[model samples]
Target chain A: MEHEEAKKTTFWANIGNFFKKIGSKISEKAAKKAGSSNKTQMLEWKKDGWKATVCLAPALIILAVFTFYPILNTFLVSFFPDYNYVTDEFGSFGFDSYALVLQDATFWRAMGNTALMVIVSVPLSILIALIITVLLNSIKKLQGFFQIIFFLPYVTNGIAFGLVFATIFSPMDYGLVNTLLNAVGISSVGWTGTTNIPYWAGLFVITVYAIWNGLAFKILVFLSGIQGIDKQYYQAAQVDATPRWRVFTKITVPLLSPMILYITITSMMGAFKSYSSVVSLFGESMGNGQNETFITAVGYIYKYFNRVVHDNISWVLSRASAAAVILFLFILAITGIQMWANKKKVHY
Target chain B: MEKELYFASDEQAKKYERIRKVRLFFVYFFLTICALFTLIPFYWMLATSFKTAEEVQRIPATFIPLQPTFQNYINVFSGENAILLRYIGNTVLVGILTTIFEVIITILASFAFSRLEFKGRDVIFALLLTTMMVPGEMMIMTNFTTIARLGWLDTYQALVIPFVASVFYIFFLRQNFKQIPDELYYAAKVDGNSDFKYLWKVMLPIARPSIITITILAMIGSWNAYLWPRSVCVEADMKLVTDGLMYLFQNEVGGTSDHQIMAATTVVSLPLLIAFACFKKHIMRGVARSGIKG
Candidate 1:
């Protein structure tokens, strides 16, 4: 019996050796190509330069025409005092557009509304996501099931979902929220229509929609971040009989800081650019008359770009460019500040 | 003889086990409630889509449709709403083309940045990365003007070309590519294999996961794109799904009814929902990988 077992082991070992020989031969070829001599390595490096340029050309050309040129043009156009859209002429160079945008009351309101959205929605979404992620991590089964259900909103078209949200918050008594409110003997609230709904109520609906939409990504990230934490940490905590809240604050939060920072910056930037969700809620006009209360920064920029001023199209163009530049600068400043503040805080 | 485990014999251990069971129950309860909140809008969308106009307008809205009908869906796909089906075709065509070009461009760019060493490579990469910080909204006005100048507006090129090369995607794929050992590239070279050949045979196969992730993301992004498509595709024939639905809503044919609007939404959203259901694991991994790496 011992002799038979030795024969079988030798057969398996022979197969492994055969595969090992092939692997070593391949690595030997690799090492040769890598070159042992300094002169040959220099020659290869020179060849790589041409290869890199050839490979990068297609993407670089497209990006230059569409991305890089457009960015430069936006900045240049913002500085043009009298830029003609139809004829493509720059009459003069000045900061007239910037001054007009900064001094405009509507611009300030838009900025305030954008700020409110980022402030309210980002933290709320993160907190809820963190709690849900913790709860999800504690469970051993049905985790994947719950994750799919939660992530449904993330995959669905945001605008279509926003439309569904609009229906639920519809001003009529038959709307979902109103119907639920009525069950508790509360009166129907005009949650959307600009006619009677308070500006705050409209903002409230937008905020809720944003937070709900934002939750899926944050939860996914936080869940992964939580799962990535060493299991031994939790085991050790349990051995010490650590309280649940204590473990969460002391262990989870500190470890998950990098993800927290990422979610905060990205969501805040997203909130600043909130347009389609607001459009879904308020429709094309966003709000009635000249005082569009619910307009966001990007929405404000879109409004100016599309706004027809007849013969003064140049003024509108300049203003739109200025608004775009302001939004860009604002994002840059905020991201810079966020990175600086969190540099020391993020665990990674 | 069997040995008794010390904790297994204690009354305190039993008490702890009971508490743990109760805690587990609460965890499930809280998760279920949150899951309902997360899922209710989708449920409402589906339920409303099937309900009668009167049912949708009924006071104390029905949790489930009392009289579900396919009439709304039928209306959406036939008659005045038949245009929506054409719009879906436009979106799918655009989506597929965008994915093809995007994946190719991203792979080439990422491969160059990852595997090839050249002078000013880091500088060029940094310049590319900076473009990501420039929001799409800022670029749209200028891109619109550029497209109009080139006479590409209202065409597939306008929708597909500008977005074909994404810096974010290139960055993602490059990170994946960099993980591949230098020895593989060297070995391929020793065999007299061309860079493109090696990329096709080895690097691509090894980095298939990231490529798949990029393809899925790009496809979804193309489908969900609204503002840019809405801006360029003004012609009725050129309208994509989101733009078409918005146009219909604004025009108010069957759009006035909540049920009909819900039906349109359900139709628009169904493809993605089905895609997600079939490839949930891949989609989740892609999203999680991107998030964690970022």
Candidate 2:
């Protein structure tokens, strides 16, 4: 932890030094331009200096207004004990929102569901993607054709494809999966409906959808990483007549570790923020009537933001902000741990 | 040269050859199965879209539409679902405007960071990088409040403005920019060219591929954005395609017709599918580059 803290501080310090150096350079240039009585040279120097700021202004302003400001505002709003979102009124600040969020069972369920998604979907997607990529690498013909087919999912809009998935996994007897099951003498299952299906089944469907949707990109990345591996290693293995599985375990995996690490961190983050897939699977409520069976952290945040609780809009708003903060912290902690773990194990 | 290769005995070689053939067959078998799995959803979506409502609901579902019809497609563009066209219009407008503004700002910001020397350059860049780590959901409530305060709710500005300045795009473009040799900039300076002139005339043209990548990514992102647009654009006419589809499913029909929903989905996804087909290499390469760098 101390080492991490030191690394963070040093990062900031480097930025500080960079700013200082630029500051001195700008001042020195200004001094030289001022010393020169030539009007055009001074104007030229001034124009160059102003040009940089001009280029940066729009991005800085927009990012400030939209990104940074909102983050800080959300953090602050999470503390407000009684904040009216519509009226822009607030009582004295406190930790009531955070406390309320922590005490709420729904919040914990959302966190648990989000964790379940990340744990189940991320690794499963990676493993499947790796297997497919390795298989893809072995092929000499129709490689591009197979790649395009695999990557089709990554291009299509998630929600749109998700709508397709909803139908395939539809709880009705005629649904594709159900039809297949029944054709083999099994009964139809309620994948999404007001009743009949287990809650976990719906969550499982969503997880399966998530893993499938996520595979395209991971497969693409791993394919490229695998293809980029030096042919010499493979040739040497061939010369040694090393077994294919051994070649994969000893060579392909280690070489592809960096890409694997990259995919894991990103997919985990994406899974935690999983929203549209659930919406596609279970609709806006993320579950059948009156059941919050599959609420994710982001979905929970959206639910509270839209719903008025106890006829108190402020209460819902503050609670939503609190939930958002918790989600952020959860993501942050996971990413940090992943980075540390990858640092120890990943090969470049 | 070697007295005899260790594994080169005739019987052993034949056995190894047989194993290799078996392994190769399994590899093809596994790949074909996986590819089918990947393509099935797309196939089902398309197949369902063309099927009649009754056919879609038939048990032992037909893999091919028994009677393919354009009725669902027609339905999507008429009746209560006619608003879908408006949603598509809204999305196109947002995508175009957001891409233009986003690409321009990203170019300017990236050019400045990559090529121009200025005070606090790295500091500001580092600060921007930190923002990338913040989850978009965490900022949604606050951004929504901010939009509401601006009286921009349900407006195109609400959808386009907040997303116009992406740090990731700027970072990606900057990486591309830094690859151009510094000597060229000095040579341009020696030719009495202004910084902006050189940037517009020389640098941008050289960095066209990255610029295209940014444009494609920005457009796709804007097109696919659902949550923020759904929240901010609550008006019936202001919804984007995904949000509009959700609205259609929930409000208009209440999850009724699989055929109609699939039809609407196909309509929404078709453009992206076409674009991907046309620019598959560029998109794949861009994604790979960004993923590796990121």
Clash counts for all predictions = 0, 0
lDDT of 1 by residue, A143-239 (tens): 9899888888878786787788888888888889989999999998878754566788888998899888888888888898888898777777776
TM-score of the B chain in model 2? Answer: 0.92
Per-model TM values vs. the true structure: 0.91, 0.91
lDDT of 1 by residue, B1-294 (tens): 001223646797788778879999999999999999988898888999999988988888898999889999999999688899999999999999999999998999999999887766666876776676677767887887788778886899889999898887887788789899999988998999999999999999999989888888877887788888987778899989887887877433212388888999999999999999898999988877765553
> Which lDDT values do the candidates have, in the order given?
0.80, 0.80
Model 2, residue A228: C-alpha shift (Å): 1.7
Across B150-269, the per-residue lDDT of candidate 2 in tens digits comes to 999889999999999888788778878989999999999999998888899889999998888888877778778888898888888898998888787853222358889888999999
- Candidate 1's interface RMSD, please? 13.0
TM-score of chain B of 1: 0.94
Clashing pairs in 2: none
